[model samples]
Target chain A: MDLQTLTYIVVGFTFALYIGIAFWARAGTTGEFYAAGRGVHPVANGMATAADWMSAASFISMAGLIAFNGYGASVFLMGWTGGYVLLALLLAPYLRKFGKFTVPEFIGDRYYSRTARIVAVICLILASVTYVIGQMKGIGVAFSRFLETDYDTGLFIGMGIVFIYAVMGGMKGITYTQIAQYCVLIFAYTVPAVFVSLNITGNPIPQMGIGSTMADGSGTFMLDKLDQVVTDLGFKEYTTQVMGSKLNMFVYTLSLMIGTAGLPHVIIRFFTVPKVKDARSSAGWALVFIAILYTTAPAVGSMARLNLMNTIQTGEVGTVEGNIEIANVPQWMLNWEKTGLLQWEDKNGDGRIQYYNDKNAEFVAKAEAWGWKGNEMTKVDRDIMVLANPEIAKLPNWVIALVVAGGLAAALSTAAGLLLAIASSISHDLLKGVFMPDISEKNELMAGRIAMAGAIGLAGYFGLHPPDFAAGTVAIAFGLAASSIFPVLMMGIFYKKMNRAGAIWGMISGIGVTMLYVFQHKGIMFVPGTSFLGDMGPNWFLGISPNAFGAVGALVNFAVATVVSKVTAPPPDHIQHLVEDIRVPKGAGAASDH
Target chain B: MNKTAEQYWKANIRLVSILLVIWFACSFLFGIILVEPLNTIKIGGVGLGFWFAQNGSIYTFLVLIYVYTKRMNALDVEFDVHED
Candidate 1:
C-alpha cells in the first residue's frame, strides 16, 4: 500500500522475471553464448537492441540534462539516434554477412593479422569498461533510492543480478531478458510522461503536448511560456540557448553518431539475427523502439522544467509573493532532500525558496530590495529530475514504483550487454584466439563466465568510487569508440586495399591522440588534479571541448591509415576475397562459426 | 564480382550516398550551420532549426534507414542475391 513496499514489490517481480528468463535461456554452446544460436527474430532482436542501446544515461539522466541544457542537449538526441542509420546502412548487414562472433574477430580476419585483432580488442575493452562504470552507478542510484540502501550495497546487489543471468545465459539469456527489459522500461517511461503531458496541456501525446497551448487557457504555446518564464527569472531563453560553440556541437554530435555506430555491444546485437536481411531491417525496428523514448525525452524535459519552476516561483518574478514559502514546500522536495540531491540554504534568513539566476548582476539590486539572499536551491542535481518527476506531479504510488523498476531495467540491460562484449573479447578474442587456440568449447564457455564475473566486479568497484568525470564520461567512451574503432571497421569493409599494418597503426594513432587530448584536459585516466593543462575553454584547441575532439582524432586516423596503406603492400588475395564476400549477401554462413 | 552483383553494390553505394546527404543536411546543416537562418521561420510553436535538431532530424533518420533497407532488399532480389 505504501510507496516503499510498492517499489520493492515491483522491483522484486522484475528481477524474478529476469532470473527466470536467464535460467530458461541458459546457453549450451559457444554459438548460443555469443550469438543466441542465430535464431532471434528481427523484431525480437530489435527490442533487445533498443534495450542494449538505451543505457542508464538515456533512461535516468538524459531528460534531466535536457531540462537544464535546453536546446544545447540536442547533440545527444541527434548524435545517438543518427548512429543507428549508419549502423543499418553501412555496418550491420555487412558484419552479419561476415558471420563473426566478436567485432575484433572481423578485424582479425578481414585484415589477416592477429595484431589488428588484439588492437581492436583493446579498444573495445577500454570503451566498454568505461561505459559500464556509468551503468553500474546508474543501477546503484536506482537501488539506493528505491530499496533505501547505501550506494555500495546497491552496487553489490546490481552486480549479483548481472552475474546470475549474464554468466549463465550469455547473449542468449541477455537477448530475451533485454526484450522484457525493453517492455518494462518503455512502459515505465511513457506512463508518467503521458500523465505529466495531459496535466500540463490537454494533448495526450507528450511530443505534441510540448508544442501545444497550456491547459489553463493561457493562449501561449508551451515553449513560448517556458521561454518567457525562465528569461523572466534571468535565465537564458529555453528555446534559444545553443550548446557551447557551434563547431563543438557539430563535432560532438558527429563523434557520438559514429561512436554509437561503432560500439561493440550494439554492433554484436545484429549478429544474433538469422539472416543479413534481418540485420538490416532489425536496425530500423531498433531505431523505432529507441525513438519512443527519445521523442518523449524532450517533452518530459521541457515540461518538467516548466513544472519545476512553477513549483518554486509560484507567481511573477521579482515580486515578494513570487517565491514559495520554505514551510509550504512540496513533499517531493523534502523526499529528494533526504537523498542530499536537492538542498537549499536561507542566506538572507528569508523563509522563501528563490530558484533564479543569482549570477545576473542586473538582478542583484532587485534581489537586495526584496531582502532575497540569493538562489536558495543550490543543489538541484540534474539526475533527480526524472526520478522525482512523478512524485513532484503527485502521481500514484504504483506509477512511481514502475519508474524505479524501469530505471533498473535500463541500467542492467546495458550493463549486461557491455559486460558480454568485455567478457567475450577476453575469452574468444584474447584467450582462445591468441593464448589457447585449441581450447575446447566447454572450456571456452567456462572462461567466458569467469571473465564476465570478473568484469562485473571491476565495474562495481568503479561504481562505488566513481571518478569526477563519471557524469559525462559516457561521452568520452563514445569519443574513444568513434576515434579508434569506427574508422577501422569502416575501412575494413569499404577499402579493399587497406592492409594489416595500416589498420593497426590507425587504431593506435586514433586512440592515442584522443586519449592525449582528453588526458591533457581531464587528466590521465581522469584522475583529478593530475591534468597538466587545466580544463578551460581558452586552453582548448579551436574552442572545441575535449568531447568534440573525437572527430579530429578520427580524421587523423583515416589520413594516417590511407597514407600508410599506400606505402605498404595491399592485403593478401584471400583477404581481398573475404572483403568481397562480406559485401555480397549470397552464401552467408550461419552465425555458428563452424 | 559478377556483373549483377557489381551493379547491385554500385546501386547500394549510390543510395547510401544520397541518404547520407539528406542525413547531413537535416542535422548538420539545418540543425547547426544554418540554424540562425532557419530559426527565422517558426514551425508549430518551436523554431524550425530547434525542431530539426531535437525532433525533425530523428524522424528523417528513421525514414532514411527504413527506405534504405527496403530499396536494398529490392535491389538484392533484382540481382538474384536475396537470401532464401
Candidate 2:
C-alpha cells in the first residue's frame, strides 16, 4: 500500500466508475443529451452541479492560497460560494423554465437574433476553454505527483479518462458521473481537513479550527499564533489587511462572483432539473454541498500553516539548519524531496534546513549574519499540500490514494461538464441554431461527441504546455464567466424590456472587454513577454486589477443592455409569453424538451 | 386564471425583493463593508465576520432558500398552480 500505488488504484477506480456511468446513462435523444431528459432529481442534479462547479481550483489551489495569504484569502471562500444566491434567486428557475439546452440557445431565442447567439457562443467557449485549461493542467499535475508518472504521460492518461466519459455520456452521462464525483471530492476534501483540524486545534470540525485556541493555554487564537510564527520569520501577520491595495481585493472578489455566475457548466446544470422550483431548490442544495468543502478550506489552510511552521521552523529542524545534511529529514520530507517540490541547501554550512522568507530584506540580513546565503527551501508548488496532505499527516496509505482519486475526480468531473457545454454549443447552438437547421438528431449527437473529443485534445495540449498563472489561472476564468455571462443572463431572465439587440450587445461587450483586459494583464495569450500597458493598470481605469475587472465588465453589460433596450421597440408578445411561462412551472414539462 | 397569473407574478416579485435585501446585506454589506466591525465579536471561538465569511452566510442562504421554497409552495397553493 505505497502512497503512490494507492493513489493509482483510487484514481483508476474512479475513472472506471465514470466510464461505466457514462455508458449506463448514454443519452438516447437530443433532449437527454442536452438536458438529461429534464428529469434529473433536484438532489441528484444538485450534487452533480456541485461537482461541476468545484474545479481543480477549488480542490487543489484554494486552501494553499488561503494558507499562504491568511485572512485576505477568505474573500474567495465567501465571494465565490455566495454566488449561489444569484443562481438560486435570479437565474436558475427562470432559465430552467426557459428550458434551453445551452446558455447561447437562451440568448439566440430570447433576443430573436442569430448574431446575439453567436456572441453568446463565443463568450461561452472562451470562458469555458480557459477554465478547462486549468483543470486539465491540474489533472496532469495530480497524476504525475501521485502516480510518479512523467508530466506529459500523466496528462495523456488524464485526457483519456475525460475522453471516455465525456465523449460517451454527453450531459446525461456526465450528470450521473458528476454525482459520484461530488461524493469522492467532498470526502477527499473534508477528511484531511478534519484530521488537520484535530491535529492543530483539537477540533475535528474544520469550520471551528480557523479561529480555535491553541492547546498550550497560549491565550490567543491559532491564527494569532500563526501570525506571530510567520512574522517571527519575517512574514506579514496572518490577520493583517493585505499589504497590497484593498481595492485589488475588492475587485478580485467581484470578478470571482461574476465568473461564478457566467461559467457554462453550472448554468447547464440548472437546465437539467424538471421544474423552476426544482432549479431553485437545486441551487440551494448545490450551495449547501459546496459550503461543506468551502467552509473547511480556510481551516485546512490555517492548520497546515501552523503544522508546517511547527515542523520546519522550530528547534533541531531550524537550529541544525543548512540542509541538515539531507539525512536527518523525516520519511515524508524525503518522499516529497523526490518530486522536486521540496528542496534544501546548506548555505550557512549548518547541517539543518532554514525555512523563512528569503524575499524579506531584514530576514536576508539576519540569515546572512547567521552565515547563510538566504532561505534555501526551493520550489514549493502550492498543489503539493492537497496532494500530499495524507502523507504529511502520516495518515493511511489508502487516504493518500483517495486524495489522488479525489483530485482527478475534481478535475475530470469539471472537464467533462465543460466539454459537454462546448460540444452542445457547437452542435446544438452553432450548427443547428446557425449553420444547419435540418440536421437530424443522430448526426447532431455524433457531432456533439466529436466536438467533445476535439475539446479534450485542446485541453490536453494546454496541460502539456501550461501557462504561467498555473495555480490561479482557473480563478481568472471564473472571473471572466462572472463578468461576462452572468449579467446578460440575468437581464434575459428578469428584465422584460431587454431586447435582443441589448442582450447581444451587452454580452459581447462584457466578455470582450473582460478578455481584452485579462489578455493585457496575463500578456497577449499569456506569451511570456508582458509589457507595461498590461500590468494591471492604473492602466485599467481607476486602479482596478485585471482579476477584479469582471465586475466592471458585468456592470458595463448591464449598462449597455439597459440603454439599448430603453431605446428599442418592445419584444414581440410571443417572447413576452415565453417570459411569463418561464415565471412558473405550469408548462415546465412541455417546454422542458428544449 | 389571468388574475391568478397576475397575483402569482406580484407575489414572486415581493418575495424576491425581501430575499434580495437580506442577500445583499449578508454578502455585500456584512461580508464586505461592515466586516471589520463585525469581526470584533465571536461565535464559538470564530470571528463573527470570519464565520460569516465562511459558514454563517452560507447557513443563512440555506435557511433563506428553505423559507422561500415553503412560502412559494404556499403561494402556489393560493394560485392553484402548485407543480404536481
Candidate 3:
C-alpha cells in the first residue's frame, strides 16, 4: 500500500478508537470526569499514566536528543524515573487520601485560605499552558508530516480529535483510551528498536543491545567505537562530554524530576485509583510501565546514532569509496526528505551528500583530499530518527503504520490528559469551588466540556504558531511545572504547620523567581529592548540554568513556609486532623469537601 | 486504635528511611558522583556505572518501590491501622 492508504488506516483507526472509548465510557458526574469515578485498577491506571507522561516529546524527541548527547542524556531517564519514587513515597498516598478534586483544592482546604488556592491556580495554568502548547505543536508536526497536510490543517484536526474525546468522555474516557494508547505507542516504539538492536548486535532486547559489542568487528565497545568514528571526523565523541558541560546536565535532571511530579495531567492520574494503597501501587506501576519505554529510549538513541553515521559514511553499507547519489538515497531518507526533516545540497559538483562534521576543521582536510567541496548535507532534524526509524531500518509497512499509530497515541493521550486537567481546574476548582459553591453537578459537567473546547482551541493556536525553542517549546513546560505546582503540593501534603499566607507567598516566590530566570534565558518571554544574560559563567547565579532553577525555588518554598509557620499561627486543628487522617488511611471520606 | 496509629506511623517512617537511602545511593550517589569509581567495573560489556546510570537504577527503583508498598501494606495490617 502507498503512504496515503497506510496513514489513513493507521491514524484514522486510532482516532476512531479514542472516540469509541469516549462513547463507551462517557463521564456521568464530576467524580467520574475528574477521577475516573475512582475505580481504575492499579495496573490499568499505571498504563494510562505512562501514556499520559510520555508525550510527543518523549515519543518523538527524547531518543533523538540522547542519540546526539550520548551518556549525558541518561539524566532524562534517571531523573524522570526517580520522580515516581518521590511521588509514590512522599506525595501520592496523602493526596489520594485527601481525595480532593484538584491540586488547588487541596491547597485551599489544607491551608484554609482561598488566596492560596487562587495562587495555585495561577501557577497551575501557567505550567499547564506552557506544557499544552508543546503538545499542540507536537500534534501539528506529527500530523503534517504523515498526512501530507499543512501545519494549520493538522493543528485543527488534532484539536478536533482531542476536544471530542476529552470533552465528551473526560478522565474516565481518557483512562481506557490511554491504556489502548500505551499499547499502540509502546509497540510502535519497540518494534523498530528491536529490529535496529538485532541488526547492530545479535541482541534483541534493547538493554542487551546497549552492552553488546558493536558489530564493527573492530573490537571496540559500541560507545567507544562511536566515539572514535565521530571524533576521527572532528565531531565530539558519542560517549564523552561536549562544550565541557556537566553542571547543566546535573541541574537539568533535578528540574525534570520536580517537573514530572508537578505536571497536573500526571498528578491527576494518581487520583483515579480506588484507594490510598492503590495510589502508591499505581505510582509504582506507572514507573514500571514508564521504565519499559525510558530504558529502551537510550538503546534506540545509541543504535540509531550508529546507524545514521554508518549510512552517511559508507553510502550503501559496503561501499566506502563513492558518495551517496542524492537521487538514489534510500527510500526512508527520501520519505523523511519529503517532510523537510532530511535534506541535501550538493555544495561542490560532488553530486553526492557529505554528512560529516562541518564544524570539524580536521574533517575539512580529509574531505578535500576525498574530492569533496563543502559539506553538502547541511541539516538533519532530530524528529526524523523516531518518526522515520522503522523506514530507516527498512522494516515492514505494518511497522511503519504502527509508528504513526504510536505517535498519535502519544500526542492524543497527553492532549486528553492536559485538556482534562484544564477543564477540571476551571469547572471543579474555580467555577464550583470558588465562585458558585452550590453549583449542580450537571452544570459543572457542562462547564467542563465547554472549558475543554476552549482550552483545545487555545492549544491549537499555540501549535500553529510554535515559539522557537530547543527540544521544541514543550521543554519549557518542565521548567514552569517544576517551579510552580510541585512545591505547593508537597508543602500542602508534608508540612501540616503551613498556613495559607505562607503557602501563597512561597508559591509566588517559586513561580516568580523561576519564570523570571526562564524569561531571562529564553527571550521567547523577553520584553522588547531588554538585554538577556550573556554568559553562562557569570549570568546564572550559583551556576543553575533556568531549566534547573525549580529545585532552588522548591527549597525557597520550604524555607519560607517553615519560617512563616513558626512565627505565625498553626493551621486549624481540623486541618491537622486531616493530615493525620491521610496517614492512617482510615476515616478518609470518599471525597473531602472541607 | 491510637496505639495502632502510632505504630503504623513509626513503621511508615522507618520504611521511608530505608527506601529513601537506597534511592539516593543508586541515583544521586552511585549513578552520578561515584560513577567514575564504578565505571572501572563492567557488566555485559557495559560499564557497571554506565549501566546503573542508564538502566540498572531504574530497574532497582521499581523493585524498591514495589517492596516498599508491599511491606507497608503488611505493616498496616500488623499495626491494625488498615481500613475497616
Output the number of the lDDT-best candidate.
1
Go through the candidates in order and give the clash count of each: 0, 11, 0
- Quote the TM-score that chain A achieves in each candidate: 0.97, 0.94, 0.93
**Candidate 2 residue A211 C-alpha distance from true site, Å:** 2.8
Q: After superposition, how far is residue A357 of candidate 1 from its true place, in Å?
A: 2.1
Q: Positional deviation of A216 in candidate 3, in angstroms?
A: 6.0
State the lDDT of candidate 3 residue by residue for A1-594, as single tens digits: 977688789878877887888899988877888988888999999999999988888887778877877777777778788889878888888888888778888778888888887787878887777777778767776776787666677678778877767778888988998998999899999888999888777679998888887665756667676777667656776665421246666666677778788888888877888787888899999998899998999889888887777776764322345467766778777666665656788887656677777667877887777766666777687765787777777778887888887987898898888888888888888888899988898999998889888878776776666553224466567777777778777777666677777777778887777777777765545333343764255687767666566777767766776777788877888888777777776655576454
Per-prediction TM-score to the true structure, in the order listed: 0.97, 0.94, 0.94
Question: Which 10 successive residues of model 3 chain A have the least lDDT summed?
Answer: A522-531
lDDT (tens digit, per residue) of candidate 3 on B4-66: 776778778888989989988887677777777787888866777777878988998998889
Sorted on TM-score, best first, the list reads: 1, 2, 3
- The interface root-mean-square deviations, each candidate in sequence, come to 0.9, 2.2, 1.8
Model 3 CA RMSD to the hidden true structure, in angstroms: 2.7
Q: Write the residue-wise lDDT of candidate 2 on A1-594 in tens digits.
A: 566666667777887887888889999998888888888899998899999988888888777777788767766776677678777777887887777788988888887889988988888887788788888878877777765655677678888877877888878888998999999999988887887778777878888777788767676788778888888777777765451456666667767766777788898898888787788789888988888898788787777777776666655323444234455666767766665656777665566567788888977787676666677676667766777666767777787777778888898888888999999999999988889988999999999889889888887786665554344777667767876688878877677778988887788787778878877777776555664375744576677766667887888888988998889888998888777777776666645434
lDDT of each: 0.88, 0.77, 0.77
Instruction: List model 2 lDDT by residue over B1-84, tens digit each.
Output: 278888898998899789978876776666666777887887756667766766677777777777777787788778877677
Alpha carbon lDDT at A223, candidate 3: 68
Better of 1 and 3 by lDDT: 1
TM-score of 3: 0.94
lDDT of 1 by residue, A1-594 (tens): 999999989999999999899889988988889989999999999999999999888998889888888888899899989999999999999999999899999999888888999999999998898788878877877777786656677778888877877788889999999999999999999999999999988889998888888889988889999998888887887887877788889999999999998899999998999899999999999999999999899999999999999999998777878889999999888877766668998777778888888899887677767787788988887877888889888899999999999999999899889989998999999999988999999999999889888888887877776543333667788988998899999999889999999999999999889989988998777677888999889999988888777778888889999999999998999988888888989888786562
